[model samples]
Target: MMRVSLSGARGLMLISTLLLSTTAFAAPDATKIANSVVASLQAKGGTKASFDSAAANGDDVVITNLKISNEGSEATVPSVVIASPVERTPGGFTAKSIAFDAGKVVDGDQTISWKTGISNDAIVPDPSEMHSTAKITPFSHFEIAGISVVNKSAPDPVTVDSVTFDLGNVIDGAPNDGKLAISGINVPGSVLKSAGQGASTLTDLGYDSLLLNIGVDGGYDSAKNALTINGITVDGKDIGKLAIGGTFGGLPREKLQNADQLKELAPTATLEVASIRYDDAGLTNRLLDMQAKQLGAKREDLVAMVPGFLPLAFSQVNITDEAFKTQVSDAVSAFLKDPKSLSIKFAPTAPVLLMDVSKAAMVNPNGVISLLGVGVSANN
Candidate 1:
């Protein structure tokens, strides 16, 4: 697993390959380019003869029967591609604005692009373990926008406004040699609606924008050998905000391809929650609403029901301070009604395995939670 665990690559590769099949063809006229595209597909082992056709406006080709997905995930689409005639570049052809569904991507105007980078060409040994054969192929620049993907397995569609990744070409391809600049990964709260139904125990989260270098100016840093996912922030409009960062070290490619192996590896990770701020009243109200939604009860009814449920939960963790619990409960209750701000920060003194934190949370949550901080930031 590489830093950031770009897990969805396989799915993206499947659809992108349908578009890349045309990379081999280029022409001055759109019609000529269309002809080349049709011919290119025809030569491949098979492109459904009935499913392939091309039309032209001026310099771009309108293609069909590419048999790819209109949604980013599914394979069901009358994929209409408008490819610019492949103009020669210093290194490779330009993958210009490609339109499908309701989005257009001006991927990049740079050199040295490979079809394999956009397409996944790896074999999956275990369905449960999400891992790909470790490979690194950096693009000069890549961008996509307004892509609404309905992952059928998931409860809702994942809509991405845009995502751009720029892995700077380095003199050497060492693990720490190059820096990858990325941003514009905006996931709206609508994507969280269904998933949050289960998370209703927390707060009803809303639209939040995450920027890595997006926050800081022109952010890019040397690569790391560990799998690191940082710059995580969750915002709840009426509640508060949460930010987290983490890096999992000692992860080799082969080890990550298995589910059971993750627990063993968690011990080598350094993770942190920079801030968790909440308005007590707003949070309690939201949690009540969430509990109501999850239990299908009226919010008023949950007012009575939740308190009864809290004892068992607190007792399971052996929290028996009536005075302290009352203060905590009262704070939560007061916060729920009128809202009072509460902020928490965790910074571990040294690296600790994620496994230790998980175990510690069961006993001493505050002490264990602090153990998540790593020795360095993901962008360092």
Candidate 2:
């Protein structure tokens, strides 16, 4: 028989109590946390949300067939599991997730959908009862292939091909430094010309291989209300490339959540063109063709006539051409064989406001985008 002493019994009871306490504090209530997040988003109104199955597994809440906002623009998520160990902070109980799932945005018609979307997000609400700000941490990536904008109403639907855009990386720096890097868009030259619907004067300018590639990178400092564009590169493949950089400030804190607030703030900014490299002959021939078509003449007759008016057309800035006629042909020949470059630069005198841009877009009379100069000739 087991014999027990009073001190031994007391020791046994203490061990049992410790075991129960450790189990209780081991993990958070994951299912309860997930329900709260989904409910909050839906409470914003005009939103309908539903999930196929939700169950607590280990420390994560697994959800399938999660659909939200299924009316105008619907989101369809196949599967997602979130595990947030609730941490009480100065702001209150904050639950954020590094967990996410791939999803698609289905158009209202149900005909087209955008696939290839990934997200890892955190929603921190105002725990102070004031609810003054949106403490949102967002991280997402979208890679779209062969995008097409179709106007079904038109008799002959306009179809553009080979469209692609992607955001490579993002960081939600909080309590630590964040990062933003590498996003770009690419389109063929043909699409730009045909976008007008009715084609006319320059339809014969054949540049099949020409492409527009622009890549952007920079950091946005929310604390200081500043967005610095570290690099913006525009590549024309065969024609040339241009690079620009600048900074923008004067962000309004009150306007962050309101779309109407966008109009009230005037951002102050400065921009400078770091470099412009273009194939001299390629540019000359491209213009000569346009002039020939407008004048109802041939390419040969227009080449010489075009150079005579080059300085006048570019009256906005000084242009230097040594042997204008011969150079244009030489440039065309050089670029046809291989890529070549001419230089350009632009530096504005004063800072420009974003609102004034719409009025000054055509002339830039304020010299906001001063054309420092450009040098393009066949001889070079």
Candidate 3:
């Protein structure tokens, strides 16, 4: 037998208290958390939902056979794995991450399927209190893989490698900056064949099928009341890249939550600058070749005809800006001949209110061109 001193006994009691205190802070009820997540999703989409079972698997909660439906459409998810470190918050719940097993959605004659989806730093707010704040986004990072879309009229499916979106710099219950990327979108040839007039033009330009990637990077600064589109780009493997960018001012934070506000605010926004650019990969020569063949002429002859034909085309649109017209004609001729890059830019001396531009468009349409300080250039 061992004898313990009073101080040793006291130390043992202290250790025991620490262990019990730790147990008191053990993870929140996993089943309850799963219920909250389902409720949150149902509230957001205005849909009905049910799950076959929800149970704790180690540190994660696995919810199986979750079905969400609205109207005639239904989405069936095989399982959802909500990762550990989930906590109950005043709003509802927050998780380290949530992952969805491969799922398929059926709506009318179309079916959409995906390999998997994962969201990081997911915040599932209380369904009953969702409208009390402007918190629009539920995750900081989200990604889906192996997406396929099938339509009844289309003979083949459209496939995508991956889609990702990221949000950060949160303020006022919304993100101040974000980015979206979609990679390896493959449109099958059979689908393009079934498409009507637009498909004909695409086929003529040497695209029987299409492989494309899209990206958008943008942000809004609430303090400045300014919205900036850094760049939006669509890139095709054997075709040209189309890029657009713009900046607008005087967008209030109140207008960020819903579509109705966006419609109401568009007329009053101020445009600082905007641009559209195209960088040819292989499509330019193909387009010229196709056009020349249609007219029964050589490609160079087709390019030569454009400069002289510009004034006639511009006259039909009431464009009397001779210098601007000449600039455009020269740019088009150069672009068609060498096929590198062409860009059109609009930058006024000062920010022009959209309302003012709309009025100018209605009253003096030709003057609107000068008001925007439009410029066109090629191969630079």
Candidate 4:
């Protein structure tokens, strides 16, 4: 058990601000929007909520499944139906209602279900261990109601409702026996129209839908000193598809005598990128550019310098039908190999996409576009 102490009241304030800001939206009925958002999360099939018995000192904190259902058209959309979970915990509450939009036929249906589990560690746990487990079913006949801003050029505007997450789950007694999952994810279609940014950065690129699925299996065994992750799967029409398998083990606190002992006690897990599709050219370029900028180089400078330094750039610069696949592959490969990581002590006003330039620059065959710096950190 790894206990993560709450920094203080200030920490709570910071977390509250983050959650409030991330979920904030401009809607006539804030309650309706909130309900709809939670419903959407349940329908996506990856929502999870968990609790740790050790953290509360064996306190009976009930965990519940979340179920959401939607019906009707854009105009007269009916209220969302939310079902409470079977397990109960402290501060547990549930509500349901219909939000009416006059003269609009927002016809759609969605259903979601979730499950709960408890942690078994004795040490202090992270704040994420407060709940047991939650699983959301799926949303049917769903649609967006607002326009998304992707780029300067206005394309066909469409409504969007996206659910984002930052989750951590503890399995049994092992602290590292944890899992994280994200779903109900969406990207604006407009961002897909741009060529420069999407091509260079993954964060800037837009997606029709994205899902991250991860899990931990096996019972706690201090003697074996091992755990396993099922795998990671990413699915969506806009971003292509990807699947990877890997293992994680490195108990820095535990002292091992030799490499062989370490290998037997803590082995390396393989994370394989099974398949990738790069059909969204404009979005890909934007992502690449965004990534380059994060490394301290201007997008235009990288693009202009590429021809002089990298042979691949000369052949891959233009977004053409013939070169689209190769270009997208190269960009994605670059992103995966050189993902950004950093620690900052400042604040900013915009979204930040961090990068690991050293790793990325090494993988670039052309070497023309070297990563001057790595990682992105933003205050916004």
Candidate 5:
């Protein structure tokens, strides 16, 4: 009888240990995760956020009737889904993905709506860190599809195919690199013609709709205290493409948190290198032809007039040096005649300090051009 009793007691201890292990690995609370996200949003600024309900659906949490407001603007989502969420810290969570369906934002007489949006590898940090110097971001990458804007004053809606932002990684609350891509921005010709002044140039250039795509990519190096811009490009189908790239130095990680600190560091900041390049698909020639027609002249005649006009334009900007002005005039004349590719480059003998450049500009603006090592080339 004693041996049987001891065996039963051992079996009970084994059963209790198994139960404890299961409880330790239990799923995260869905409702708590939803509330923490609302808390984080509110902590960010003059924003209010809430959700009607949150419940677990398999491994995902579905938040219903999510709404956010800032100032007089309000946005509402029918539902949001956070998939496979895991707690990273107390009141912080990371998820495999988050999704939004059919959201609308209302601001005065204008409304913006989207069919769907999704973010991958999302991070929701503690509320206390939202306004801190940490600069925490919520997601690594996100995309929204079928975005439409409607206004009471406008005749028709403007639509976008997609808008996306990507941050490769977050370390110490800063992105290692970043990108923003906006594609298929369609604005009607009537809207452009009515938008006053030079906007009509777009329509006159035979653009029924200004279908534009914009992209920006950049990265930072903490070790070198530098920021590198891969490129910021604007491409219009059948029009032209413009790209700008540059590198800047003397930006330490800590100074990024405060505008005042950055301002103080600006004097010592350096422009290491910079470039602007434009490739004309057809728009450059078309624009020159249109302008020539308006002035009752041929395209070649218009091109010839630019070299004479440039000095007058440069003089307005305090550019008095004849040699510098001549260089610019010749480059512009060549580009206008060929309508091919034009590139402007700056590569100083050494990284140029902002303070020296500023003082030189005030003393002699024309000298500042040479001080920056400006170079322009056409059809190269």
Candidate 6:
């Protein structure tokens, strides 16, 4: 028995036959790869089209408690426990978030722990190796929290503590290439004034609680075709301290040059906040002397007059967490007495995809603006 060493037992039987040939090579149906990543993020529209229509018609968007843990030969990365029920229909939006935790990806790293909004720890990759590699790169931290969205002429109820997306390297390749990113984001002026239809600026600023700070660098290079939004910074204390500069130019070339006359042109991308401040309250020189009497113009013409007179722009704004700062300061004093009705609307020929705005600036004497800086260009 002391001499039983046949070449170390044939190298431990070839490392147990390559760990049973990578576990018998069959592990690719994480609910059909999470429904083809929720249908390629609903055909790549903005704000990922409200999370792809709340994961397609809301209600248990798959992920029924899957748990797989292995460490010895390294093979973990499957720990999802989700319970969803989010309805945003005709005017009857509903909400529900119970025990949502995610994290467990050892070899390729992907961590998660849930409570509703969503906890974080991510390095993500191996969506089963991105289904045999057409082009799969991953790095993530897409967090969410106790989020809520309701309609039917809202009065009270809109909460989201977090919405983090630091998708560093999300490339999925070829002609229709890829890229999605995020950098240092913090949203919580009670989820940006409880979103849409104005929650009354937290009852006229008697101050209960309000805090929304945000930061995000940009990138979306489908192989240098271009879509780079590299600016947007906002601070808050009841709708003050803002900075939204510029940098958005021609970006629509994931190979769909015509796709039937660009699907009947309805393209749009606008952003303008040109200036705002209140900590010291210089009021940017009384809003640049009221834009120099509406003609001697300055502040980049009030941020390029936001698409010729405001409709949508101020790309990505944030002030998360606020209960009811005097109903968001009397709805930002009636949205600055009609600041062009502060708008937000998206409809690239809708298909379970739309984002309308105005919960009185999305909630708490609030002012939560988030525009993924819309893009789609190529009209040489």
Model with the higher TM-score, candidate 2 or 3: 3
Every candidate's lDDT: 0.43, 0.48, 0.85, 0.32, 0.86, 0.36
Stretches of candidate 2 off by over 4 Å are 1-30, 83-102, 109-117, 120-135, 140-214, 221-225, 232-243, 249-258, 267-307, 311-380
Candidate 4 runs further than 4 Å off: 1-190, 200-227, 235-240, 251-380
Per-residue lDDT of 164-235 in model 4, one digit per residue for the tens? 222233334223333344434444444344435643244335444233222223222245433333444454
Q: What is the lDDT of residue 192 in candidate 6?
A: 41
Give the per-residue Cα lDDT of candidate 3 at 302: 87
Q: Which residue pairs in candidate 1 have backbone atoms (N, alpha carbon, C) closer than 3 angstroms, thus clashing?
A: 267-353, 271-372, 280-335, 280-336, 281-335, 281-336
Question: Residue by residue across 1-380, what tens digits does model 6's lDDT show?
Answer: 47758998999999999897766543323353344443433333331211112222223444443333334212221333323332221211112322244322223332233233342332223223323323322223445543443333334333445556555554443222222222223333454465543433442333344445565555555653444445455554444444343322233442234455444323332222122222322333345445556676665555444333221222234334233333334433444433322222222222211123233355421223233322211111
- Per-residue lDDT for 1-380 in model 3, tens only? 99999999999999999887767645556678778877877886768888988887766788898898998999999998888746655656777898986998999999999998999988888877576345656789999999999998889999999999999888766788889999999998788778888876787676878999999999998887888999999999889899999988878767755566778777668999999999999998887899899999998988888788888888777888778888998899889889999999999988899989988987775788889988999998
Report the C-alpha lDDT of model 2 over 111-213, residue by residue, as the tens digit.
Answer: 3333333333344333343232444443322233333333333223222222223232333422112333222233334444555533322335555433455
Number of clashes found in candidate 5? 0
Estimated TM-score per prediction? 0.44, 0.56, 0.92, 0.25, 0.90, 0.26
lDDT of 4 at 75: 24
Number of the candidate with higher lDDT, 1 or 6: 1
Worst 10 contiguous positions by lDDT, candidate 3: 128-137
Clashing pairs in 2: 281-331, 281-332, 327-378
Who is ahead in TM-score, 1 or 4?
Answer: 1
Q: Against the correct fold, how does model 1 do in TM-score? A: 0.44
Worst 10 residues of 4 by lDDT: 50-59
What would you estimate as the lDDT of candidate 5?
0.86
Candidate 1 residues 1-380, lDDT tens each?
65544667776887788666654432335444444434433443333323366676555556664442222322322554554545332212233445444322221221111111121111111212212332333234444444454544445444444444444333342122222333333333444444555443232432242222231112223343355444444444444444444454556544454565756666555442243444332455556666788899998776655545766876787756565456456544444444455444456665555677778877775455335431211110
* Better model by lDDT: candidate 4 vs candidate 5: 5
lDDT value, candidate 6, whole model: 0.36
Query: What does candidate 5's lDDT look like per residue over 1-380, in tens digits?
Result: 44658779899999988887677555568898898889878885799999999998877899999999999999999999999888876568989999997999999999999999999989888877765366667788899999999888876788899999999767776677999999999888777877777778788888787889999999989888888999999998888899999998887867765765767777668889999999999998888889899999988988888788876788788988777777777788888988888899988878989888999988888777888888888888
